[model samples]
Target: MANAGQKNRLVAVHLDESIGRGPPDIEHERAVAIFDLIDENSFAPVGKEEGPYKLNLAIAERRLIFDIRKEDDTEVMTHILSLSPFRKIVKDYFVICESYYDAIKSGSPRRIEAIDMGRRGVHDEGSRLLQERLQGKIEVDFDTARRLFTLVCVLHWRG
Candidate 1:
C-alpha cells in the first residue's frame, strides 16, 4: 500500500535511444537502477504537487535533460543541465567500475570488496553532486539520487 508521499513519485521512466545503450553489464546496471528507482523513490519537481510522474532522461548537445510529465503525458517541466560538472566524476566512476569488474574475475574476495567499496564511494560522490546540481529545481532523496546517478552513467556511456 502506498502512502501520499509514495504517490508523488515516478511511475514510468525512459532513456533516450539516441544516447546509445552500453554493453551487457552496463545494460544490466541500468535495468536494475530503473527497477529500484520505480519500486521506491522520492521525486518531486519544485512547487509541483501533481504526480506519479513520468520521466524521460536524455543527453543532447552535450547536455543532460530531465523531461518530467504527468500520467496522461501532460507536460510538467524539462530541466536541462550542463554535462560539464559531471564529466570528471563520471570518468572516475567508469574507471573504478572496470577495475571492480576485473577484480571479480581474478582477484580474491578481500580485493573485490575493497574495489567495491571504492566504487560505492565514487558513486556516492556523483549522487551528492547530482543532488547539489538539481537543487531548487528538483528534490530527490539520497537513494533516489544514487539510482538516478546510475542511469546518468548509463546515458553517458559511449561504448
Candidate 2:
C-alpha cells in the first residue's frame, strides 16, 4: 500500500491466451481495432490520436505500448498504455486502461511514452475520498491514476 503522497501501482499483463503468444505474423490489427473503439468508450484523449478506442468511464486520452516479458521460454507481448487526468464529480479522480497492444510491427520494438498532462486537466476525487476514508489507506495521485494502463493489462486476471 502506498502512503498518502507516494503510491506506485503495477499492473502485469501476462496470460496464455492466443494473443499472448507471438504469432507467426505479428501485427497491431487488434490494437488498432481497440484504438478505433476509444471515442465511443467516453475517452477523449489527454492529447490526440486517430481511432475508435474503448476509453474508460472517465474522460481522458488513450496511450498505447507493448509490454514484453519472458515466461517459460515464451516471450509475451502485452499491450501497455494509460489514460490520464480524469475527473468524476462522484468518483472525483480515476484512471482507465485504454488498450493493450502486442509488440509486433516487424523491424524493432519501441517504447511508449506517457501522455502529456499539460492538457489532461487530471483530478482525482474518488482517490481523495479513499485517502480520507482510510486516512492513509493508499496514496493516489497523478502517478497512481496514470497507472490505469497497468491495471488494464492485468484486469483479465481479476476474474
Candidate 3:
C-alpha cells in the first residue's frame, strides 16, 4: 500500500543497452541506486492508474528515454527528456565526484569534507532539476529524485 498520491512505485528498474557499459564504480553506483530505489520509493505517473511500475532508462537521439511499464509488464508511458539542460550539472557532478574520491586518498579530512559538500550540492541540484522536468509526467520525492538522478547521470556516460 502507498500514500494517496503515490499509488505507483517502481518495482523494477532496467538500463538500456545503448547506454553502454560503465567502469566498476559507475556500475556499482547504478546497481546501488536502483536497489535503494526499488527497496523504497514512491513513483506515480499522472493519471488514473495504479502500479508498482517498471522503468527502463536509456539515451537515444540526444534524448533521455524513460520507458515505463506496469507491474505486469504492460506499457505505461514513454517519456523523453532533453539532456541539454542537464549537461553542465552532470559534468560538474562528475568532476566533483572525482575530486571527492581522490581527496579520500590524499587530501586532509577538511579537504575531503569540503569536496564532499560540493559533490552533494551538485547532486542536489541535479535532483531538483530532474523533479522540475518531471513535473507533469511523474511525481517522486526528493530522495527518489536523487536516486533517479544518479541513474540519469550513469546513462549520460559515453563509454
Candidate 4:
C-alpha cells in the first residue's frame, strides 16, 4: 500500500531494450519484479510535479537513465544516474543470485538458507544505495527501492 506522500507512484514501467535474453530464471525474476513494482509502489518525483509517473529505464552512455513521465504521456522528468556507484553491488548481487539458484538445485537445506540470508542482505544494501542515489530526484519507500533495484540490475545485465 502507498503512503500519503507516495502519490507520484509509477503507473507503468518499460525497459528501453531487452537485456540480451538471459537465463530463464533471470527473465522470470525481472518479470515478477516489474509486475510487483507497478502493482503498488511509491514513486514521487521531487519539486512541484505530482505523479502517477510512467517510467522507462535504460542504460546508455555508461549511465543509468530514468525517463519519467505523466499518465497522459507528458514528459515530467528524466534523471540520469552514474552506474559507477552500483557496479560492485550489482556484481555481488549477480554472483549471489547464481549461488542461490545452484543452492536451490543441489545444496543442503542449511546451505540454501544461509545463502538466501546473504542474498537478502546484499539485496537490502543495493536497495539502500539506490535510495541514497535517488535522493532529491525521486522519493521511494524501501519496498519500492528494492523492486526498482531489481530493475536496475536487469538493465546492468547487458553491459
Q: Name the regions of candidate 2 deviating beyond 4 angstroms.
A: 1-122, 146-159
What is the full ranking by lDDT, best candidate first? 1, 4, 3, 2
State the lDDT of candidate 2 residue by residue for 1-159, as single tens digits.
122121121222222343242322222422432333221122212222322222222111343333433223233333333423212322221222121122122223322122212113322343333233322322234333333322333222221
The number of residue pairs in model 1 that clash at the backbone is 0
How well does candidate 4 score on lDDT at residue 114?
98
- Candidate 3 whole-model C-alpha lDDT, 0 to 1: 0.87
- Candidate 4 yields a Cα-based lDDT of 0.88
- What are the Cα lDDT values of the candidates? 0.92, 0.28, 0.87, 0.88
The per-candidate count of clashes, in order, stands at 0, 19, 0, 0
Off by over 4 Å in 3: 1-6
Candidate 3 residue-wise lDDT, 1-159, digit = tens = 233345578888999876578887788889999989988787878883888789998888878898899878899888999989999999999889878888888999999999999999999999999999998888888999999999998998876
Looking at model 1, the pairs that clash are none
lDDT string, candidate 1, 1-159, tens digits: 133357678888999998676888899999999988888888989998669899999999889999999989999999999989999999999999999989988999999999999999999999999999999999999999999999999999999
RMSD of each: 1.4, 17.2, 2.3, 2.1
lDDT of 3 at 99: 88
Model 1 TM-score relative to the real fold = 0.96
Candidate 1 runs further than 4 Å off:
1-5
| Residues 1-159 of candidate 4: C-alpha lDDT, one tens digit per residue | 344356678888998675576678877888999889988898888894888889999888778899999989999988999989899999999999999999999999999999999999999999999999999988899999999999888878853
